[model samples]
Target: MYMALIELKDVSKLYGFGDATSVALEEVNLAIEQGECVAVMGPSGSGKSTLMNIIGLLDRPTHGDYYLSGKHVSRLGANQRARTRRDRIGFIFQSFNLLPRLTALENVALPLLYKGRSPAKRTRKAWDMLERVGLGDRVFYYPRQLSGGQTQSVAIARALVNDPQLIIADEPTGSLDSNSSRLVMELLSEIHKTGNTVVFVTHNPELTRYATRVVYMQDGAIKYDEQTKLGEVGRYARQVMYAVPETTEEDDLAGVSAIMPVLDKRGVAADKKTKLPRRKSTSHKKRKVLKK
Candidate 1:
């Protein structure tokens, strides 16, 4: 494999200090090669999203070094990092972070504007990107006017409009219904086939099977990084029985046990809606902690 476009070497990110500190990641090393799609799977609070944010330049680590596209960014200042972000990285989220008022074309054009591109050229490029994502006819629609799948398509177009070297996605499908999720995954697979590096953090292994490589995570570290290649010829069929018992539990989540990484926010609501027994929601208010 080629030298990673994003390399994490013995990275560590800690919150708070010795007496009250929590380790998010510890000596975690990873290399994401160009043109490969690697899925990071873990549950809420497992530091998987922490790794994603660090890799995406949204946050920094407490220790260790990181090299993105050959530049050591661990020690870079905020401005330098911001410029690097605008120039090299593209992000997609499960929530479909599209501006509510901007049409699909305008939404896609926003990133190029930050890069100092002129309106005329950026619009043309954005229109092309929308068409590429199969949203040509919907370019004039606002976010609320589009379906969940279409909104995600717009978000994907926005992420690609800048032509960044790496696409960092966190739970890109966690917001959609099953059908919408399938469509988004198919679109993502097509985008990967177009030759660009992708590192997506998701809890969905059904989608991970489409990745060229899989990075299974647990307790904030990669447990199994295996090569995965599924046929694109047809979909994976699910056998179901209507008479089957309905329950809140499924074996799929067993894979994510004890890993609590990020909320995978889009799915958080649906998961709550399922009427399953789950942990009670907690407010942002922090409780007082006395010294041990």
Candidate 2:
């Protein structure tokens, strides 16, 4: 049986209390399988960032359960959670989050230091990841010396340097231009293809084209969770849609027939037709709460 890479049940997050209380996430439930690229979409204050933080082990939910790779982690102590984050989760942020004073290679090597790797080994591994991300030439360049795209590439290399299985990116392309955004998204797609689970939050629906599944959120709850029909047929269709055709009618028909079987077998239509079920609150006693 297939297991979820990340799972959340009845998860909720609240801040302050009484009149000052704010509900950032309410009873949100979600599961993401390994090797899937999931894009979380929502407006500002819709709890997308909060959900990412909880998944990344930076924060704990106020209520309910969270399981990462089938291990219950919602209630783990701070130090334990920190260790889990270091070992199992990788993070990418909108601002790149690279240290201003550190070179691209040094920033990528920082995580390995916590794993007790020797300085030489850490530097070597960091160099490999930077090279993988097309930053080999900029390894010694500080963040200020690199362009915006190069900075983000370094951040991506740093995130993957630790070889974590789960990657969480929050608005990774928000600060980039169209060309830079395309580069970042393509890099993320490459990462997902390697069987690592990727979950990112984005406000742009156009970016969802690169994701296998899209989860839409509203009012701190999931409103829609649907798969993108980007199989062989869909990809071919997209290519044909963009390219001016030069083939004859018979050749086009033959090409269509060749891909029809894959489309039928994959049931692409059914996958795109998912709906979120209405959820009812089980408890009305909101005045009091127990601390986790």
Candidate 3:
């Protein structure tokens, strides 16, 4: 059986109380296995961000059980949740959330400071992560000095610097232009290839082409969930063609071949591709720290 990296059972989130209450999520159940790249798409007010926040441990479900790598965390106290967020999850935001005063390296290293790493060690690891994200030369550059894409890349490096098992990205490409969006998507694909579970919220259906599974939400509940053969050029081509307005048959056919070549005649199956190696769980450490 595949080990689930994230499991939400009848999860719900609400704002306010009694009649004034607003339901942001309604008994949502989801299981994301290790190494799966899941795209969560929905219209505004459909609870995509709420779900991301809940899953990222930034907020607790109003009611339900949340298991992250088999540990029940839905009821964890604020400090415990914060530690879990720091130790086990990496978050990417559409705004690229870098500290304006900090250079790329400093921003990336910020997370490690809480872990009590020496400054030199933090710098070394942050620098290595920046290099991994193709921003090694931009280490000393401030956010103001970077393009939108570069800023997002730095954010990604910061997210990965802690080597978190799960990456939660909220509309990561929403603010980028077409080319930058494509670049960010490609980078996300590379991250998924490294056996990390990635769950992202996106409005752009085109971006779902890169996902192994797509979850659609409506009215604060899951509307559809389906797995697809990613890495199949035809799949993305078909999605793009459908999204384009008033394309002719000739254009559709030509677009398919020109867009992205099929990497595998038989696309890698999710079951096979996502059989990630098990890692030690840090729940105990987090709990101990929280108890202190």
Candidate 4:
């Protein structure tokens, strides 16, 4: 039997202590095979970020185990975890965390700097990675000079500079508009086509088209998981997108009232019971005076 590229067995993460303790992940379990593109979706405060952190080896579970490439990794020490993360995992974020002053090439080369690669080798590799992401022409542009989509492409190049086995993107297109978002997702899909194991977090139902599997989380647990064909929305997500009641002219006008609260039908009935005197019509008097 083939083992999973990533696996979590009864994993949990907690913050604080004693009465103040908060559960970010509650005995959560997940698995991803090599070359599988996965999308994780959940509402705010639903443990999606925490789960990604643990899977990416940025955090350890408070209880249970984690396996990467079939190796137990949940209990690795700080330095060991850092090394493993740098060697095997790449991260892309919503903010496109690039140094503002550095050119795109320099930013993409930053990761190779930590690995002690020679300057010439790093430059060559970074240039090639930028070309792979279709930003070869923009390699010398500063982060401030690039559009949102270009900036994120630079971030993706940086992430892949190390040739990591797994890619973890947390809201990679959150900061982009619709066109830019599509650009980023298409770039990611191209990477997936080249046999990378990719896991991304997104709240957009439409983005699920790029994923082979979709995981839905709620209340710190995986509520649903489904395999979906590429280029189509997942079944559960499709249900959610179509669940909203379609609006019509009648539906839009239903709750509106032409009368003020004092002149409302119910208020008029109460006023009649009290026998209150109604004000004479000033508009009628004005019309009579105008005729004279």
- Model 4 misplaced stretches (Cα beyond 4 Å): 246-292
User: Model 1 lDDT vs. the true structure?
Assistant: 0.73
Please say which candidate is ahead in lDDT: 1 or 2: 2
Give residue 228's error in model 4 in angstroms: 0.3
- What is the full ranking by lDDT, best candidate first? 4, 3, 2, 1
State the lDDT of candidate 1 residue by residue for 9-45, as single tens digits.
Answer: 9999999987999988888899887898887776666
RMSD of every prediction: 10.9, 15.0, 13.2, 17.1
Q: Write the per-residue lDDT of candidate 3 for residues 259-290, one digit (tens) a residue.
A: 21221322223112322212324242352343
Worst 10 residues of 3 by lDDT: 268-277
lDDT of 2: 0.77
> What lDDT score is found at residue 175 in candidate 4?
87
Ranked by TM-score, top first? 4, 3, 1, 2
TM-score of model number 3: 0.80
Q: How close to the true structure is residue 89 of candidate 4, measured as C-alpha lDDT? A: 93
Could you give candidate 4's per-residue lDDT for residues 1-292 as a string of tens digits? 5679998999999999999999999999898999999998766677988998999999999999998988999999999999998998999999999999999999999999999999999999999999999998999999999999999999999999999989999989888876788788888888898999999997666678799999888778997888987865656554433322223445322321111221232233332232211232324235233322
Q: Could you tally the backbone clashes for each prediction?
A: 8, 0, 0, 0
- Taking all chains together, each candidate's TM-score versus the true structure is 0.79, 0.78, 0.80, 0.83
